[model samples]
Target: MNIFNRFIVTALLVLFTSKAFATSPIITKIERINVNTILVTFDQGIKPVSHFDVPIEGEFSVKLYTSTTYYLGSPNSLIVRTPTAVNPNDNGFATQWQWEEPTLTATDNDGLSEITINLNAYHSDFENDIGHSSLDYINTLNLIWQHDLSITSINTLDTNEGTNLEHTLIASDTAATFSIIENTSGLFSLSGANNATLSFDGTNTDYESTTKSYTVKIKATTGNDTNENTEQTLTVNIKDVTDTAPVIRRFTISQGVNQGRLIIKTDTSVTVYAEASGGSSYTWSSSDFSVIGSGAFVTFIPNADVGTRTIKLKVTIGDYSSERVLKLKLVESHPTDWKDKNNNGINDSKEIGRHNNELLVGENKKITSPINTRLLLGIMSEDTAHLTLAQMKKYRTDNNLSDNTEDTLTTGDIYNYVVENFSATATTQVIIELTSPIPANAILRKYSPATGWANFVINDNNIQSKTSNTCTDDTHWQTGLTTGATCLKLTIKDGSENDTDGDQNNGKGQVNGVVESTISIAIPAASNSNNNNNSGGGCVYNPNAPARFDMGFILLMTLSAYYLIRRRRCFNH
Candidate 1:
């Protein structure tokens, strides 16, 4: 049992152990490219052998090779040998082999299987340090055999625009490395190594309009097939959301060249419109539903009354809506061709009747049709006999003017007198009245057909009780009005800096500022006040009168006293 026997046994044990743990060649391809062609692959090289002379039934010879020159490390440098039927060659290895078997057909072996080859030691670990000892070993290398390996796919995706595309639901083989072979839409992408995932980047640009579809060609590979690769198309369907709103560009009839203040004449019609970008429509209405109708160019007839009215419009596009309102007014027709403006079967009678007894020529013809209050008015005279009853009656009779001044002189009576005779000279009293309290700071003015508006003055005194809405100013012949100033006007004048210089007329200005009411002036039988301010026989101009300048008189008195003082000094000398 000596050292010699122990050495022999230990050497045999090491040899067998190295052969058992040697690396096996990897099987990469096992699928038939066609019915007659079989493809095979391995991680290492096969030793090549020549074709044999003897053919066994339907079988032909297999080729093999060994590659030993360029690899490194323990498993990196291992070698391969064929099944015992084929022999290994000297300096070559072959993963590509040609083998014909009587039992093999494309129909019978349709999926994954393997081929077994023997693996031998590194050239550095060669037995007896020889290069040809690989044929003696029984250690085998198993590779993917020539019977099937392939990949399938899911082939479709659905997503929304502006959404991230990470689709893990694409069904594919786990053994493959996935790639996008064609992506015309620039939406499909890939990531990861073995069995990659499909990614999509859907932006607004990715979808041109509302809904769209895209196609991408994807391929999965194991680096095993050499002749051709299989590719599939992935259909991407993009989705869109709907829009829901409408807009109205114009809501009121406040447009066009001839319109003023949203007000139209009786029996007149107007149109309204709205707009929307997303193919929208509109429906028209009124506060009084019977007045307006629906359309792009809907027309509305204003009510046959002088009052405010409201019109409404509703606009819609898809599921959205907007509404608008129009506030408008209606008024009576022109006086020459008057219509039943109030729709009450009355033609201009109520409007004309409000002014005392009858309408006056060239007066404000536009009136609200259904007035409830009495329109009171008056006329005063110049500083002479201008509006005397005889003269007024003659003018009225000559011009066909109405003499409805029976109870008291009506607005028509005084109006016609001045319209016929503006040069009749007189001086008189001023009359004014209202239903309620007058607006504060109102005054009376005279309108001369030759000049313009002027202040009315009472050189004698302001008479009458001065009630809330009524006042009477009695004038004297010498200190009141000019000979024949045509019209008289009463209006509110909230005293501005430009109204007057506070003299020549009842502490009032040269202008009335706002018109409240009016009539003509008739001479009143009154005498001048005894005050020195009006005793001189002069024209009492209400504004811009010479009597308003007292500064010149004071200057003249100062000059006269200086001259007298100098003459007295000379006389003393």
Candidate 2:
């Protein structure tokens, strides 16, 4: 070993160590050099013969300085060399490198970082240098990298942008409200979501006076990892919502009687209106409240019960609707024959009664004899006769009469008496005295017999005696004969009577006759001895021929004869 040989070997070893140290980069301390620039220093003590030589050491340390702005790259990383000897000269050598990320240095006065690096300039150089590094060398090197990142933010809205109409309108002066919304597309969140306000500026200055354009500004925040400021402007064009209620001025409907045609008129173009809201078209409804027509104008046909119906007009525009109540007053084509005379709206019994009085002819005719007369006598002919006493009494009992006295006769009782007593024989004449003035065309027939069966022949002027030409006073005599005879008879013929009375006359042979008579006759006594043995013997008088007698005179004679017989019997006793 010569001195020259030793010096050459030592120089080679030193040179190899310095190269190795240069190839292997390490970070011993990290420092903020500036806001935008980062500086790195390496130790030159250990050197490798070539860039591919392997170093005996596993770890190394270096110093790193950072700025606010820096480029993140691989070429700037330092690593150990591999596949090379300790000799200074080696052709096949490889070097390994790693990246060292640096921290940003913030300025004291301002929160912003002042130093920055041209990332685009150093990006390719750094990738080419450190990307070919070995695993062990790259892992042993300590290096720092830095990069600048950016965040984007946006604002969003949860509600839609439109006007909200709350009230229905009848006139055109109604006001509407609109809400301004910010649409963020779900990218960001608003700071005061509910407190965001909308300012309006337009022709309608009463709402807002800033004429620049209506807009809604939103204050928003983004992700929590980054401080981001976001804002969005919502262009608000407050369209006329027609929120002003449609003026339905002078809405009226004229209808004819019996559900005739109804003509409707309104001051507005939308003639038909209703109670419902939000219909672009109007639905004209009838009494049933059905949609008959869907348009601006409509015609409604009423039903039978809906004579004069009050139709409701409903008109809807967009989300808002309006209604105008119109009256469809009916007009009568002709006056009703029966009206509510009692002033009540309904045609009740009292109204019907009044109408009957006005329209019916025999409504006023009633019986006068009884206290409360309601009986009406309608005589068809003049040859009518009075009833017998027994028949009259039977009729009264059958008709629920309380007593047999003739003084208290109800209208019904009087009518029954007249009907039962009178015989429809001939054209009988009758005179009626009414309790009140009779209505027109009333028929009355009632009479009293003053003489012999009251033989009457219905004449045009009065009822006269058929056989007797006696001048009978018939003024107070409703119907009676003036002549006295055994029997009274009435004759009726189908011929017009040309007499003194102004009574209606019809055809001939329609008259009937009734007879009343009294005669003196004898009835034979019973011839049985057993019946005679029960009574004492008395003389029985028998008449030889029929003889007419006065009933009063016969009655007197019979009473006198009985008295004389009694007196004689008393004397014998």
Candidate 3:
């Protein structure tokens, strides 16, 4: 145990202890340069390695560099570049860099020796720093965490013209809310929980009349964070429905003039036009007769075929076509020839009928058909040369056959007549006189081939005074008719007339140039009231029927006024 031997042994022990336990690199601070980058500082200088790994839950790369250029607290620092940005809402993460003192082939400066750095090695003490040599150590690292919202699964979509479109909105956050921020077309809406559902508005779209496409901007937001919101634009396209059936509507152009019902006359041409929807082309044809032209419109002349014939129209679009058939008739035009079997100043054959027990004269005539049917007709024309009643048919809806003041009644009937060759410039007039007194509210309604029905207003301004006439104002006579005449006279302008068969006129099409007219009467109910028992049997025309003022109503109104006056007086007293 000498002094020299003890000193040497103590020195050796100290040297061995110093070599066995050595201080490792200590991480000091972490700073976030941007959302995708971070700066990491350590207590000691770390070797500049090409590649390394940090215990973090994302994809990133690290660069070891000198710290004096950036004045980061240590001589060794790391610059982390994360192409995938971090979620700001992740709070703080437990991340560290660890290495074992096993196999690192360190070479001299500018040496070509290969360096191996174990980056993914597992260690037990991850939560706490493991103090070791500078070449092998674990250092804790801190990063700024963030949240980012993203919109996904939204793209261009397509739907049929008349159908609705629906799509589920997808976002980075499950609790995110979606809203339509920009929609100029007003055809889209966001609904359902959190507004996560996008849908088309409930409106039927027409391919022919509506906009073809729509563009809208949608935004996704969460947690009341403006920075966490995202926006995207979506497009919706409308597809046409080619299989939709075509619809056909019928119309007629008469004499190359005004549009009206179909005209069927011998040697006179009329045009039939078919207006069809969803049709690219139209073919007008007929098996019974040859059509004059082709396509949407076709003109035809009856010639001598004076009966019903079928006209067919075929509409085609792409590979589909639809056919519709229409029935039309042709009638021969006749000239006016009324014979005077019994000689008189007036034309005898032109007489429609006579007044009760009297013969008509001058322009007045009587219709003497069907036995005991009395009708007086008056014609006022400068030249009645070519005028003729080309056709006349009676519909069994009405009847009025009785002498003066007879109580005979009948349901209303329609009288259709086709007047031919009348002077188109000079207006012709007809005066119809019935012997029996009609109901007070009776009206004469006229029918046109184009428009269905209208009231035939009587013209009293141009009424002609009759000599030796038995009609009177009391009998509902025209103003200048006979004062004591017991008949009702009506004067109206003629309307262009037409009456086709049932198959044609069943609300599909109508023939032009045939005048259809009817008289409607409101028969008085059987009542013992004094108004019904008036001197003329309620046959006067009353435009406004005033309300009756019975004795009870007058007394009640008087009492009500008296009560109001009494109440005012009491209040004043």
Candidate 4:
């Protein structure tokens, strides 16, 4: 145990301790630049654990200093390494490798002692950068962005007034916004709202066309207006909806038209149509339900109670509607032979009543007036029908007519008195059967001295026609009457079609023109019974006789009847 042996052991121990300190590197401080980048500062210099030149960028790992256990960065972030400036010695020991990483921006003064490293500049080539590490990076920290964002067009936006459209814009900054820059027409409004809300304002469809789109340019910033920013595209879409209101231009009556008014008759169907713009639906109604209409290009029907009516039609298009009105009326009809002298559709002779009102037939409603004497008389008579008995006397005195002492002036009495006093001829009606049945809409009419071209009720649907010749008691009139001899012109027309009343000859038929077969009628006739004989009183009257022979057999019948009675009495005795 000499002093020389103890010195050898001490020297070996000192050598081992120095080697241990050189191999280990201690990291002291780290500064975060952003989410994926940091600056790592170290307390001592470090030498790379390994160095290799790779042909391709692939999976590999490296450490700043060789150690049995510790690593400074995430292993997943390391892939490959670059060759160092100071290569390892033959014994795998070297002071450090040359630091030359483009991302690893650092400064070194005293070799391997201290350095500034930027982790954002960290690539596999930055390994063993051979520079001293320190805390200088804490003074300079900045954010850099490399992310991209954009916008897509929005389609098929809808609204009742037009097209209202909205587009969702996405970005990486704290907020999103849009501004119109690429739009040439300036027709679009790009609103930049800042609440990170789902919808934006200042954009509407009212001013835009239905099928057009506009583009916008926008600048997005990250948190602040710093150098970190991105440029994006924006699209705005707008559409047009139905906006036109309906308009009624013209009105048409489908049937029962007389003058400007609808002449509703017995037929169940009568329609009114309004030619309009943008009409999709229709609503029809009458002042009274007696005439009701339904649907677009509506149809209407009359009820049994006859009078004037106003029919209304409403048409709609989109959100707007329009209405139109028309006037209609129902007038009483007479048989083909009744005379309505003034075309009033009322028998002229029936207008001779005393009225509750002061109107008289021959005065204001003058009997000689050319306009419409029959209509005036009908109005006068109808007015007086409701009068009290006391009022009738005063009306008679005002008109210079006979006073009626009866309790009331009935319609029958007024008409009968006028007929008896007037020179107009009353008709003797006969039923003339036809082969075909007339349509319900068919019109039965007659134009003769007894009737001035008016409507009639065709009994049994075209089976009978009234005659002009008056008759009484005699049911059978011999069938050999000449053409036009009776002067009774009858007609049947389908008024629903284009048939017109041109004077009285439109569909006229005379005594010879009518009568497909012999027939009889029950309508009462005027006086002068058995008047069918143009051969004067020669048509012998016999209460009952054979089809041919007349009163000439009456004498022989009388004589035979007397003999039969006598023979019966004698046989009984």
All models, RMSD in angstroms: 29.4, 38.7, 26.7, 28.1
Q: Give candidate 2's error at residue 390 in angstroms.
A: 78
Q: Please rank every candidate by lDDT, starting with the best.
A: 3, 1, 4, 2
Give per-residue CA lDDT, model 4, range 348-398, as digits (tens): 345545221112322223212111111122212332222223444454454
Tell me the tens digit of each residue's lDDT in model 2 across 457-499: 4444453222222212233332333322211222222222311
What do the candidate models score in CA lDDT, each in turn? 0.39, 0.30, 0.44, 0.36
Q: Candidate 1 regions off by >4 Å?
A: 1-244, 251-263, 289-294, 333-573
Steric overlap count per candidate:
32, 72, 24, 13
43 Cα displacement, candidate 3 (Å): 40
TM-score of each: 0.22, 0.19, 0.27, 0.24
Candidate 4, after superposition: displacement of residue 130 in Å?
48
Kindly report which residue stretches of model 2 are placed more than 4 angstroms away from their true locations once superposed: 1-11, 19-241, 245-284, 288-313, 316-573
Which wins on TM-score, candidate 3 or candidate 4? Answer: 3
TM-score of 3: 0.27
Residue by residue across 1-573, what tens digits does model 1's lDDT show?
Answer: 799999999999998887766654444543433434444444455542322442222121232222321111132333332222123344545454344332234223533233333233222122112122132222222223333334444667777766767765332345556677788878778876554677777765345575488788877665666423456787888765333334333332322332322345545566654433333566777755255556555676665455445566666666766454443445453334434322221234434443321222333321110122111111222111123345444434544556633321111222211111001111122233322222222333443322223444433333222332212233322222223322222222322211221232443322211112222332221222222464666554333224555898889999999999999999999
What's the lDDT for candidate 4? 0.36
Per-residue lDDT of model 3, residues 394-476, tens digit only: 11111121222111222222332222112121123333334333444344443433343444444544333233344432333
